[model samples]
Target chain A: AQRVTQPEKLLSVFKGAPVELKCNYSYSGSPELFWYVQYSRQRLQLLLRHISRESIKGFTADLNKGETSFHLKKPFAQEEDSAMYYCALSLMDSSYKLIFGSGTRLLVRP
Target chain B: EAGVTQFPSHSVIEKGQTVTLRCDPISGHDNLYWYRRVMGKEIKFLLHFVKESKQDESGMPNNRFLAERTGGTYSTLKVQPAELEDSGVYFCASSLSKAGGSYYNEQFFGPGTRLTVL
Candidate 1:
């Protein structure tokens, strides 16, 4: 079975402060990781993927195979960044179905 | 290009009543997916469709849930006699390409329908 875990239910940070949302996964085979965010009153959107290694909205997450983790990080938090973030994982063979974490709500206070 | 769209932004129904949620994926996207987030739980995959065909449905919780995509234009998920445990948000997503290779195809999501069962 594949599983994704977002340890924190909520993370509060002041504007311009650095933030990190922790995520861990368990999969026997190769894993595909992704970060998705849902802003207030908006649909959930893809933030970034481990395969791309690209930054979105100043947020980046590296998939560490050694630790079985994929933690999302941002140097500066913006009020607009306040949203629900989910870390997702899927095995290479079953990439069509995404297994998601419980999600962490980031509150960026101005 | 229009993103994925789901009808009935919110629905409230008594237990034992049926509810059907609709989803219209982005134009030209062959892949459509169904996911649900139950109270205090992670967003979980319910199924996947390739055009009008069911691709994978291993995640479906039970037979109470049925999904269909006619003519590959739009899809509908019907829940018969929804239970209190079914109250949560249901999300639909779509992707353009097949799953494989180094390139990761992004799945665009709809606003999602918040379902409340009494």
Candidate 2:
């Protein structure tokens, strides 16, 4: 069974400070990881994916195969970055069926 | 293109009642998915539809939850005799095609319908 774990329930940081949301997964096969964000009154949208190796909204996540971790990070947090972040994992066998982690609520205080 | 859209942004029903949620996928999307997030829980996959056919429903909790995609367009999820545990936000997503390579896996999501069963 594929499972995603997000260790933090809430993370508070000051504006311009670095932010990192920890995520770990347990999967036997190769895993596809993603980060999704949901702002207040907005739909959950894709922020970044490990496969893409690209950053969105200044956020990036690196997938570590050895550690089985895919942590989302940002160099400097902005007030607009405040939102609920969910880490998800998709197995190679499953056709895009994502197993998500309990989200982490990020609060960037101005 | 218009993104995935869900109807009844919010629905409140008492236990034992039935509630139906609708979702309209992107015009040309051939793959659709339904997911839900219970209180303090992670979003979990409920099912997947490829056109009008159910591709995967292994994640469905029970037989009470029935999902259909008629004519390969919009989809509906009906929960009969909704229970207290059914209270959650249901999200719908659509992608171009399941076989269209990895890029096609980028799914656009709906705003979700918040269901509160009292």
Candidate 3:
């Protein structure tokens, strides 16, 4: 039962507000987590991976093995940050296939 | 370098009709993958190709779907007698294959082809 779950279908927030997009997973093996973003008219791009431990565009995610979560968080939301966010999981093995969550749409209002 | 590209950005075909989708991965990338996303569902992997050989195709749904990557270059996915459930956006991705590395090879995605089965 390997799966990724994004609880919020849509998260609306005003500019300068803190934003959090929840993501949880259920896996039996070592997990490699990633957050991908898709802006309007743009292709999907990797935002950050837990392994990198680096922030991208002021956003960050922390992998909690005990909670089985890798929630994406940003201190302040910007209009440009509005997009579809997907959380993906892959095994630490040789396989490259990704298991994606249903995704969440974040709308940052002015 | 050009990213992965998919042909026929949009396709509309009736049920029982056939449709072929093409993808050209980024040059020099040896790993190519196909994914599909139905309405309201998460994207699911359909297959993977390492050059001209299929590295894994456990996600392919059925026999009506066939994928081929000839000459270890461009690839094609053909759906014969497509059903309503086959309607979705098909995505192609590519990444450089690495040997024994901790750096996660990031996968670049194409714009994707939206297929409609009426």
Candidate 4:
């Protein structure tokens, strides 16, 4: 079975401070990880993926296979960055079903 | 192009009532997926469809839920005799078929339909 764990339910930080959202997974095969975000009143949208190695909105995440983790990070968080972040794992099976972690809500205060 | 769309943005019904939710994926997408997020829980996958065929349904919670994609263009999820625990937001997503590469396409999600069972 594939499982994702997000230990934090709510994280708060002052504006311009660094932010890190932790995520860990348990999968039998090589994991495909992704981060999805939902801003207030907006639909859930993809933020980034491990394989893409790309940063969006100044956020970057490195997949640490040894740690079985994919933690999202940003050098400096913005108020707009506040959102519900979910870590997801795509199973190795043919269908590539996504298993999502319980989300962490980030609140950026001015 | 239009993004994925789901009908009946919100529905409220009593327990044991039957409700049908609809999803319209982006045109030309071949892979469609269904997911739900119950109150205070993570978004959970319910099923997937490759074209018109059901590819995976391992996440469906019980027999009271039925999902179908007739022409591969759109899909529907029916919950008959819904329970109080069935209240949640149902989301639909779609992606282009896998291109020849190590990376698969990103899925675009709909706004989701919020269902409330009293």
Q: What TM-score does each of the candidates earn?
A: 0.96, 0.96, 0.98, 0.98
Which runs of model 3 end up more than 4 angstroms from their true locations? none
Candidate 2: tens digits of C-alpha lDDT, residues A1-110: 78999999999999999999999999997788999999998889989989889989999999999999999999999999999999998755545778899999999999
Estimate candidate 1's alpha-carbon lDDT, on a 0 to 1 scale.
0.92
Pick out the ten consecutive residues of candidate 2 chain B with the lowest summed lDDT: B96-105
Query: How well does candidate 4 score on lDDT at residue A16?
Result: 93
Q: Is candidate 1 or candidate 3 better by lDDT?
A: 3
RMSD in angstroms, all models? Answer: 1.3, 1.3, 0.9, 1.0
DockQ of each: 0.75, 0.69, 0.76, 0.81
For model 3, residues A13-36, the per-residue Cα lDDT tens digits are: 999999999999999988899999
> For each candidate, what is the lDDT?
0.92, 0.92, 0.94, 0.94
Clash pairs (backbone) in predicted model 2: none
Q: How high is the DockQ of candidate 1? A: 0.75
Q: Which CAPRI level is candidate 1?
A: medium
Ranking by DockQ: 4, 3, 1, 2
Candidate 1, A1-110: lDDT as tens digits: 78999999999999999999999999998889999999999999989999889998899999999999999999999999999999998656543678899999999999
Off by over 4 Å in 4: B100-102
